[model samples]
Target chain A: MSETNPPIKIELVSDPMYLCGARELVSCIAHRIGFDDMECSKIALAVDEAMCNVIRHGYERATDKPIWVTITPLSESDESFGGIEIVIEDEAKQIEPTAIKGRELEDIRPGGLGVHIIREVMDSVVFEKRETVGMRLTMQKRADRPEEAPRISSRSSCPIPAERRVS
Target chain B: MRERPIAARAGGFPLSNDNFIDIEHPESGVCVVIPRHDVDMSRSPILRSAIKDEMGSGLSKMIVDLGDVQYMDSSGLATLVEAMRGAKNANVSLYLASMNAKVRAIFEIAKLDAFFSIVDSRDEALSA
Candidate 1:
């Protein structure tokens, strides 16, 4: 609200199936804002991971619970610091972030890797647990990776008719 | 209606002849030659089980040749890592050969390229 050109728009939903849709929307937003493929992939993966946690870990198949997701563009100052801000909130359960530590490959059991993947892919991951409420997770990612290319598909070869080529 | 989990094969094991070819060697053990396309999350579970079944058949040394694989994702990487870990836990050896740049990028991103031994050819994966 403080002097940013167009205040970033927000989309809120409480449906589980919207999870996949949300990922696509983030990718579209990233593209509109000029984020590279790797950055877009990172955001998509982060969304999948977080939503998986909320669905599997927090609600445990209880579809009656609701999850909150907020997307906001960082202010000029925040952009200077790096990336967009994504916040996901859930009032289903209050769980400590530390409880979701990465297990060694030996202990690669099903259902525990989601939270670990979320923290690893995102640049900064913060988890807050409120009393008698749920947990909020905040994440940041750089809109651009210096080492990554612009993501033009390398296979540029296309078949052309000889008659068309002559023109 | 609930979306059925992706079924890799119909009334058969996960290793479809379309995606993998089984090869066996006396000295090096059994190897599965991965095909060129469709090596994504949908097939990872089947790939993992195929590797496990091969290991269970007393083929300690295993090789996965990704010479033709053009794309891979995190779940694919996770499957490969799990296969490698499974081999180690079972006291067997595992190797990969001819990883393409796009598929290899996933390994690099997952920081697993350094953890696994990769070679250029099937023979190399078998012998080394």
Candidate 2:
């Protein structure tokens, strides 16, 4: 099996306005890939949250910092079983990867839901530290296809488990 | 005659002069904050500051009109959560109104629909 689809790459300043552009791009790409309106929005939202985290936490809101994003379609031969892979990189302070979890939902406050939102929308989320500096966050979401219906998880149908639901 | 400053500032994050947000005083002790753009990480700070300022000014009632917000991310959601917390601490009541389908879906996914007081219209929010 061979993977050959060229990934779409976008580089922008660590500004919120640019995140809107990125969201629009991701929504269009997801729609082009046959995702429904709701699904496309979810994917775009996940990407938006990830980029926001990089800017606010990773880059500490340094508008001059550069944020790089890559969107690649996972090949059918891969384990993702046909999905999209989004990689976001930033040159900001690196923190413990385990600290990325969203706050307990039961607490009902704000300021920490970004990480949780990413986890809820994407199938897999991974955070890695770069060799010298910076950090990389990778997220993947499998498409919903008729043939692979069972494999697709709907947030509405498969609610976040009681144990995993953060306060 | 002197003109009154319409928006308050929170810490270093001032209410941007840009068209991204609009703050309105619909009634006494009630402020309505509207985001004319997508609520994402980039724009959340502005919204947060605006809400904080409103809370600080002793506005015990708030209604966030999402009528113009077509899209929102977790960053945006977090701002709302923070505002809600601030409102509680100050003994204020925060209400959200006119959320579009997409924005509403994000809240549903996060299971925050149960946590926040969301109404269908600005009128309902005001009355609530």
Candidate number with greatest TM-score: 2
Tens-digit lDDT track of model 1 for A52-163: 5676677774656777767655533433533466788887678667776665544543334555566667777888885569888887765444433122222543223222
lDDT of 2 by residue, A27-47 (tens): 766655446667778888888
Single out the weakest 10-residue window by summed lDDT for candidate 1 chain A: A145-154
lDDT per model vs. reference: 0.59, 0.76
**Candidate 2 chain B: worst-modelled 10 consecutive residues by lDDT:** B1-10
Candidate 1, B33-112: lDDT as tens digits: 45444354335556666666667656667778777664454556677777888888887778888886545655554556
DockQ numbers for every candidate?
0.12, 0.58
> Which prediction has the highest lDDT against the true structure?
2
Compared with the true structure, what per-residue lDDT tens digits does model 2 show for residues B1-128? 11123333333433453556677887788888888767776567778777776686657788899998888887788888888778888988999999988899989888899878999999999898
